[model samples]
Target: MRYLLPGRAAWAVSLTRTIVALVTLFSVATQLAALSVQPSTATFSLDTTTLTIPQVDYESAIYYRDGDPYPHLDFERVDRRRTVRKDHTAVVMENRYVKLTLLPEMGRVYSFVYKPTGHETLWQNDLVTVGGAANDTGWWLWIGGVEYTLPGDEHGTTWAMPWSWEIIENSSRRKAVRMRVREPGTGLEESIEIAIVSGRAFFEARICITNPTDGMVEYAHWVNPQWTPGGQNELTDRTEFIIPTDRILIDERWQENLGPSPQAWQGNPLRFIRGWSRMGDVMADGLTGGFYSAYSHDADEGIVRVFDPDKTPGVDVWTYGYHPTQIPMGSGGPNAGYVEMWGGTSRTYPDERWPLAPDASLQWTEWMYPYQRTQGLTFANEDAAINFQVTPEARRVVIGLCPSGEWRGAVELWRESVHDAADGRAPLRRWEVTADPATPFIKVVILEGLMASEFNDLRLRVGSDQDGWTIVEAEN
Candidate 1:
């Protein structure tokens, strides 16, 4: 064995692992003291004498995004055995998923598609007292106070699925999130809000759903963070997609909702992609821990989300999936999360979007720690040897599909790739990780898609350089 330090640090405790699971645990303890605030348990994360999260609502808090200004899933049942845990950063109001929305059926007097005029539903619930609402239905969201109002869909339950209150205190430059019942008959609402904060990198995630009145609804949701630099968030061309390694059961109509039906012309009654591909096997990581993913916009944008069982908890990690290029606003609502059957493109479950189960919630964890890639795997440069011991079989992800085609580039890579979707073309270069001095990548390789294009022969390109224009004869 190579020479190295021995023994583990005292305060660092990783719940399940320990033979000596030896590294110094970075203390989250200074972050452990519970916070207290006004009205609700929520409090401002700032260390001030007073504790209250600044309120953000639909009306007063919307618009103006980009750069430094803005700031800003899951499934299954089986009553067998379940565990629910909430890990918070001791700061108040930073109460990640602690809030819930209690919507009522009689509320939406002005549902977008259902009304003759574009007006917001008139909410008259004893549970909710409306304050200053938006001017138009398109402006249904109300800002200022920490409360939002939503009338019921044609068939949705009044029960809430988190994200119902005003984000009293948050870092997004964009205002409050608004709930629209895309489908009238369901009891679901897609939680939609955009966070526009520049600088600082951390894995920030939120869930959106179109309420469904149909039986048990099952749909997937993904965290869309454009990765960036020191922040280790997502950057423009940086991408990555992680998935699980097991059989996947998806709605048959999902593909029809996005584009053309590969089997529709043949009388397949419009089909869905129903089975798992070998692609899942190639991207499987034994040390993935089935949770949050770490990324940088520049380093990311190249990665893809992984979907399958080996991925555990059966969650899909598709990134820049669907809209490779950003979609123009106003044309259609943010086509991000899922809603009811009428709401989501894929008509999964009983034509509705439903939560996991009564007491069972699907949770995910992503390690946003900056990584140095080697042989298709991303590892923290400062702790490569330690990471190796803890994650002996962690494989950098590659080979998967999304809105665009499957990704086939490197992680934290500085190289370039190109493609053209106009012509049904595939990438020509194989996944490669190299050190481009002009680039900041330590070493990277394509982790989501397979490259099979020839110079100038591939139809598209990704990353900052010319796609298919170059090749890595050898691995770094």
Candidate 2:
């Protein structure tokens, strides 16, 4: 298997597993049938490659405007309390692990509920208003949750508008609900396909945007997920975001408001955690695997958003200064007091642009996984959910996992010796345990002869009968 390294193209890590001693394969069935009509539900497929989720559709009356007043998407009236019934429709897809609510009107996730935690992963607005203050986008709307924008600037036109949708339960056990929309004035067609892996607490969003015009077009693609750490109705000071990046830049507009010496806070920005500091937005660039997470140690659970940096290379943290200013009318509302975890184009500023040729298309994938752990998450994706803390001085390492549904095998931990920065080290201290989604995978090791800093890599190798060996590494 090929592994993509940070800043560069590729890196190699070899994992070994004995096939005969530790192999477990799920038996595949020959057929599967839906149990209901409107809300379709089913279990594993005949091929045992996928799992079908029950889907239901309903109507929601939302408030929105037709014009772009600012650079992003926002409603026209912030004070209006009017809602038209049947204005738009919503869909719900559910499995045993998670329940996802989506708005076909804008191709955004209305709510993401993790069954184990019984918490909504995305912060939702009680009232879907139409307008708000300006940002990189024109007039911004504080609808809450995860929304997809493309081919234009912040919060594209399609977010508050309607889109076409279809739900399919493929034979391989994979079920997907696809939503598509064509920009009214532009020659861009955007679509988002969402799917869940059977019994796993995660969902994947595959986004595609195409340009059909004869001339070149420059646009931005952003997958914005408004998260309230602890998945509560209100944002609390206890909520903190964990992002892995090589560099971070404070928003220029915010720096100007700081009245000089903005770099002082560069070392530790958490000093502005009062929930009213209005500390401007921060952009984390040059991420290793395009993974960003937010967790509350008090709640012991949080959401992780991972994407392909090659397409969506920017990870933005948008804060409404500490007053919940992003949603003026939403003050004291469900959508009030939130921060945005945005994965989008490499262009961090509003002025940056990426040009696309005629008929060219861009494709990308995003994974939103909810996990239970308060410590700190080093890495996460569809393959595995890991939380690890290493006290180099203490010579102690603690790790946990929410492994993939297919990972019903074993997890073995190893410590590699440090030689040089470029050389991959040798493995030591083998600690193995059974991998099960029904239970948390945790392992702590006190090094025998090597200090935590001396080790080049702390790796976890997952041995499975179906896919062979999968390796997940922690920061050295």
Candidate 3:
């Protein structure tokens, strides 16, 4: 069965949802106004002025997949009923820098838009589709944006069902919303709290998974953030999905994207193999860096996802090969290529699944930053000191550094020529700068004598004079 919600019907449904949400908000406000607050001895304040969460119905097309594990039927005529009910609500959380729209009914992010560039960071599907009777996985629903997978990887049972959400806290400094669901199959409780500040360019996602059972239960906690590097209109082949990992573990069933092959790879199975070829695909072997970035050099806009290594030990990058034409079950349009930077508890795919005993819970925080010209990120800390730069040339290049708090250290810059790329990269030319702890670490370098043609790579390392140089790790 398949159904498509056209623009007119979608607008009607959205209007209805908005009216209902406004009435509900008015009623709640009236009730809260009747309460009397006693002035306390301590200073306490809460602000909900800038925070407004309204509901709207999103229109999309949905259908079932039967031919392969994950298939997209392109046939036009719909055997199923054309008239489908708009049963889901899109909760929009907007701030100064970005706006996050979520569907509570499905516990999925409908869209994440960066307001500065008016670009969406998540790859979104315009039509809402569901699996048919033959596909009994319960996860028949598929749309773009970030979707949470709990109790197990892939789409768990909870994703197809509705989740409960509420604005837990509202303040002038920040606004926070919490969405949660309980897995019926495993009695696991998964919740995600998203918070955004007033003028910040980044947002935070705190994911918590709990095993309520008395016996030991093995589960994987992964923050699967998907984005089409070049957005929906641009070609994905021009985008680069950068994961700082030396080795990549691949699924054996993943069919190699042979250039002349008549068909593309289908389905996303949970199996892992020792090695795989990079080939024409744009993906790294495995991710070694605590952060992953996908950027379109041509467009000069991209996003960066940073995770705390102490909490999230495993990170990897998964990207569907660059296809100029429309692929089955892909994002909305032609240039829409899929790239998912996964931060999980296990190192490689299925290599290790976290074991949680009764009443045990695992939680972690993920930070996402959207930028206009951030070519790539070398390293990042929890609070600040996110170091990245654009295309590096020998003579001079502009480096973007975000250093805050007590960052009293020296940032060292190095360059490696293409000729020295075989062995290990050694520091050819060194330039160091020391800055105050309270200043922002944004610096532009002028490699006066160095020629742009001679260098193939640029490196940034941080340390004090006493400590030499060290990798940039998250420091509280």
Candidate 4:
């Protein structure tokens, strides 16, 4: 069955749907205008609450080594105790589209909820246990979320420590919280400001790292997000990683289990978490785009991260692999498994460290959001995300978009060979709508009985009338 909407002949059939969509758009636009007028009144809110969680405590023996400046914990002699209830402070920021929760003590975003779908995009561990070997500190605390690491490699030095935070911005358009921590091990100060704004679906995280020492220091910074976009707090066979890269360097530990280093990303089994039989870590060698995502086909939901490739060039994927038994000890329950998407200043941990001059600082901005009904993602940028698929076998074309802000735009499809002639011709198809991040726009067009080669050379573009700009364009 072939279906088309807003076409010359099909307009009458889709009139009712068009009216309903316009009404919804009008309502949203009215609300946004009201919010803009009342600058003092905030549409978003930021507050703190106490959370009682179950955690297993451990007793550790501390020891110092000769010629070593920092003390280390003896994980070999530590004793594990029974689980107990503990109270922690949770900072929450909410808007109409999403709700974000952060734990200052953990120095990470504990939860990110997309209000429209009622799905938690970040993986949260049920139990907090302390175990596992780290690069600098031998032991690591196994509480999961979006953890920020800096001044050191492999989990950093402040993930488990307390951080000071304050409300930095509160207005009708935006609300944010800044969490700061001074690393005692490296004498560096790190702060991350997480913000949620009105009329936007994504949350922004701005990170700043300052070196106060008299001598130059080498350090590594990474934002590690453990994602379970399916909302089940687990990984499934259908979960796929979308990294726009040509090659990947598999970590040495997984070389035998997976394959050799520097393998092509396309046609590689590493794209899916289920392809691996054991735990592994892989780093993208060259990033062709500024964004990456982890999408689940079963749930039709995914997490997208947008950042500047010039500033934060590093991207890595780590998975606990498949099955309950493969889940690392002290991290989560039997059903707990997640894919960790890491973005940082350096490509690989410990192997490549960036140098920070004395009294110098580095800063960058990144946005994270949850998207749905896209089937998959092909391209993404600061303004919008696009999925353009041409299924010649099915004789169909699908266009999906998730915009960051309110947009009044037209999606146009053009046959390049015909459109590029001396006399410019009109598009083959055009659909107009008012869309925002909360309301994603998707359209499927049937080619009918046309041959596949007829549409092979095509261009898809999203043009915004309000801003007089082209949001995104893709050619297939």
**Which candidate ranks first by lDDT, i.e. highest?**
4
Per-residue lDDT over 1-476 for candidate 1, one digit per residue giving the tens place of the 0 to 100 score: 00111111211223432211111111211121223222232221322122111111121223434432211100011110111121211112222212111121212111101011111111111011012111111122111111222232211222122233333335433222233333222333544332212121111223345434535544433222222222211122232222222222333334333333222111121111122111111111122333323222332222222222231232222222322222111111122211001111122212333343322333322222222222122222111100110111232322211111112343222223332333644433333433221122332223334333221121212233444332221111
Clashing pairs in 4: none
> What ranges in model 3 sit over 4 Å off?
1-87, 131-138, 230-235, 258-287, 324-335, 350-352, 382-398, 402-476
Candidate 1 error regions (>4 Å): 1-235, 246-250, 256-289, 292-312, 317-476
- Candidate ranking (TM-score, best to worst): 4, 2, 3, 1
TM-score of model 1 vs. true structure: 0.27
- Give each model's whole-structure lDDT: 0.22, 0.57, 0.51, 0.72
Q: Give the TM-score of candidate 2.
A: 0.74
**How do the predictions measure up, each by TM-score?**
0.27, 0.74, 0.64, 0.84
Candidate 4's C-alpha runs over 4 A off are: 1-43, 59-72, 76-81, 329-332, 417-423, 448-456, 465-476
Model 2 agreement with the true structure over 84-197: per-residue lDDT tens digits: 222235555566666666666668776676665667677655433334222333344555678887555556656645678877654355667789987655667888898876
Candidate 2: lDDT of 278?
Answer: 51
Expressed as tens digits, the lDDT of each residue in 1-476 for candidate 3 is 11122222222234444445345435433332222133232212322222222222212333446443332332233322232334345555555455666666567765666655656678643333333322224334435567777555544446554588888877777767788988765678999987776555566888888988888887766666777644552324456555565444444444353222122111121111111122222223444557776666666666777787667766655544445233223112233345666667766443357788899888888887666543344555444435445333435555545432234555555653323334776553344544322234465556665655543455555665575545432111
Question: What are the per-model numbers of colliding residue pairs?
Answer: 123, 18, 16, 0
Q: How does candidate 4 fare on TM-score?
A: 0.84
Q: Find the 10 residues in a row with the least total lDDT in model 2.
A: 24-33
In lDDT terms, how accurate is model 3?
0.51
TM-score winner: 4
Off by over 4 Å in 2: 1-87, 133-138, 170-172, 256-267, 270-276, 321-336, 404-406, 417-429, 436-438, 448-476
